[model samples]
Target: MSDATSPVPAAAPVARKVTSIGLGLLAVGGALSAWAFFDEDLRTRFGFGYMVGFTFAWAIVLGSLFFVALQHATASVWSVVLRRVAEMLASPMLILAVLYIPLLLVALLHPDSTIFPWRNPTSEMAEHAVHVKGSYLNETGFLVRTALFFSIWIFFTWFFVRGSLNQDGGRRADITERLRKFSGPFIILFAFTATFASFDWLMSLEPNWFSTIYGVYVFGGITLSALAAITLALSALKRSGLIAPELIRKDHLYSLGGLLFAFTCFWGYIAFSQYMLIWYANMPEETIYYTKRLSNGWAGVTVALAFVRFVIPFLFLLSRQVKTDERKLGMISIFILFGQLFDLYWLVMPNSFGEAGPGFGIPELGPVLFFCGVLLVAYGRFVRRHPVVAMGDPHFEASRGFRLH
Candidate 1:
């Protein structure tokens, strides 16, 4: 696999299968979302429909990009066998760009009372001192900022993925070096964009409420989710019998598991720190965010995060055996992915409906399915164009002989 002259098998058929499934899911999910839009009750209950769509779409993009960064940061070989898998994750950014249509519609049509309360100039909510303090929370500013965000994301997705595809055409070592060079700057840009993106999309739900660490909190979740996604993708490829079992060793699993553990801790720390600061300060403005979640049906979600997101995974992944076993790691990945979704739901839903309970009804399921479909199709297309591994990569031999201990 390391030989530059080695023949690389074409990935067209597999790519097509992946694309078909992705498109099929998108159609089904899109239909559900369409129905939710027309169904007044469902739409009202899932009041954060637009926000959910935006967040889910962006989450996948950020998650995939974060995986790329981690791969570079650790210089791990196990992931070399799966680097393409991680790179393909970014393919959804294009589809997500289109998904923003509905969000743009919501902002344009309901400038005042929609998700961002600050949009409504005459509303009493807008008169509050906190809302007035932020000049960027307005309707026009929101649209402009969103457009800029998507543009930057789409550009990086194209550049990075394009370079990988070019490598399949027998590019030199310099091509890989170019990617590494771009990686540093890309990571920095990703950190800033991801933070502000969370603030703009999720935090603005309650214009008066703000947290300095909220961006880092969201990044932690995104990173964890991306790792889960990578594990799942690798498992799927193995199941398909396309990936060589020997290529992915227990050491790789352990490394990925360790990353999951580290981020799990980081997410908990951020969540607790934010909560504690607000609790100690007892400021009405800051405390109001927690107040809404603690009351009504949102309280259940809070408890779910405490146990599902942190405690359970924390204990389960603590073992070296569990971390190194692919099947066990894959199962834990699935759990973490679902937990992250629930975490996002807990964050956005409370503000959408003050006392309304959180349910995985059409409003929630529709966007999730739709975006998921898009992700599948895009990733499939990417995989089809490139070799599953970097055959010409200088480190390919090192990756092949990678060991755990």
Candidate 2:
């Protein structure tokens, strides 16, 4: 018998059919995206959209890794039931690393590529500050540093995920201890990579503008969106009778709700602080970012982002009962996931399409749909390769029967 009140059963592998559906979607979405790239001007827009798309996907996967790492480092019993889902979430990283190539090609081969301002210097790029940034912002350094980030991400993702999967077959206690020991320092490594990666990829889009808390802002979105995605997946698994009853407890949902609530606040705080600091300083470079976003039809997106990402989630999740209700949680999860997309659009599209405003059609939505297909297929196959629940975890029962008190 397991240690906690409920005896948890090992979860069965996900169905192969689910993986097939995901693959089908990927193929269809990929075809549409390729077709869109034929128009020269549309191709440029696609290039920007491509970066945003992968970055959106990366944020969720890396965010899950952060959650899993944090839980392991703290020896958190209640979250053990959800750990496997989080692991599966991180499984898409290798494929994501593959998707990053186009962005690199845009930076390297296309002389007219303006997705990254520093990569192709214009008259604006010819300014004194651009020259000052020459050493750190060169094409060679950008590519090399990006490679380094991927090296760290792919290697560690394999290490952490492989350790968890190995536990399923062996049920080794030492394995758990090793993961615990590794996670503490790994969290620090995650922070550094996340910060610099944001700097290199997103902030560099507008070379002159910068925010000290930009990485944290990105972190908040990643964490919140990852949790939302997990909750939605958990709900789907439950509805299909795949998850064990004991694994879906009020306390566990409540914990997720608490986290969802907590991060919602953290995101707001970080956003307000970053905006306020920049507004107070009144520096030209710092002010430019908010100015573009606040004007040009983007201001509406900014408002909607606040409401969807923070206000609605925070308000809905405040009540204890709602978190425990799976259906309600699923709705909130979808909302937050959508919010992450809106927030990224607000941050990025304004730079390229500010004059034209937020335009949506097949052109805008194509790459995003394609990447989503990739995420689903990658995640489904990963879960199919192993048990959906971490039966080897010593804390499995405690997690299954976890209570908030």
Candidate 3:
């Protein structure tokens, strides 16, 4: 097929302006995170730690979504039109991997008390459980696991991104085939790494608590959040006239919106299922996690998530018209994004502050801004190097013609 007929492009280079707004936000956010981290007050420090963690976690979500899109783009004929968008999203993974340095520092310097309770030798809180899981949750073990996780993420992201960029530079068909071959194994690696990463960072907050489904629940939440972020980014890019309107139609918007809705439901189901299982089993170790959340000010936050993340959006997005309308979809996207923040807050904050109460002080806001800034800096650089679309895919024709069934 000719360039016009094919969904993928040859060697078309697109110009993207250098916008430092995201970077500026990151700088201010980082300063706030640092101040919160060192503050003497536990409540204040916990709030900031939550913010910092959430900010970085959101960046990971975005990057992972990008990777998921690329998987579809390279493998599925249905995704040719949306492939470029996925590529744009995946481009930031490299930076997300690099930004792990600070988190590593946090995990290393304060292994005993910051997030992992088992790190402390004197804590009676998980004394029995800690003794059991000490082999895996210890400072030395955690460092090894974390290093392995980042190493895998960094390798896959670089390999996938570099391969796509090479295609843009007019590499031979063999290179394209090589990328397709690599994607399958890369995805498998991602699945394992993401699961382990979630367990270490979030689930381990209550080391005694264990759930096989926690990783899946987190994956669902991150996927939904990432889709919302992609929609917002695509809308913003289109507004700037960077992407061709012909390439992005109501059909595309509908597909994305539908996926968002589906995942929202999936996240809720997984969350409730985990709770139900724990509640039914009534194991003291597992029940304590929810018990803490239910008693403290955290109960109110949980109610908010039930309404904002699931119920409200679930009802609002039920309409066919809402999914296809760009303006409406964009607004809903904003809602989902905020809901995601709340969802993470609910998950991490309680572990840090218990049921004392929920608050969004500098400790919370600063890290969020800092990580957001890091994301912008990375995304900005990616855009500057490549076209917003995948011009070389053989299935571009089918992608442009994609429609809702």
The candidate scoring highest on lDDT is: 2
- Overall lDDT per candidate, in order of appearance: 0.76, 0.81, 0.69
lDDT of 2: 0.81
Error of 3 at 275 (Å): 1.1
Q: How accurate is candidate 3 locally (lDDT)?
A: 0.69
TM per candidate: 0.91, 0.94, 0.88
TM-score of 3: 0.88
lDDT of candidate 2 over 240-279, digit per residue (tens): 6667766788888878878888998999899889989998
Write the residue-wise lDDT of candidate 1 on 1-405 in tens digits.
122322334355566688898888889888888887777566554447656655765775778876776566556556676777777776678678787777656544544335666667667676566456657776667778778888888887777767766776564678777777777787888888888888888887777888999999999888888888888888777766557777788777788899889988888899999999999999998999898888887887898888889999999999999998888989999999888878888888876667766656778787877777877877776565555666556676687777867
lDDT measured at residue 100 in model 3 versus the true structure, 0 to 100: 62
lDDT measured at residue 314 in model 3 versus the true structure, 0 to 100: 90
Local error of candidate 2 at 384, Å?
2.0
Steric clashes per prediction: 0, 0, 12
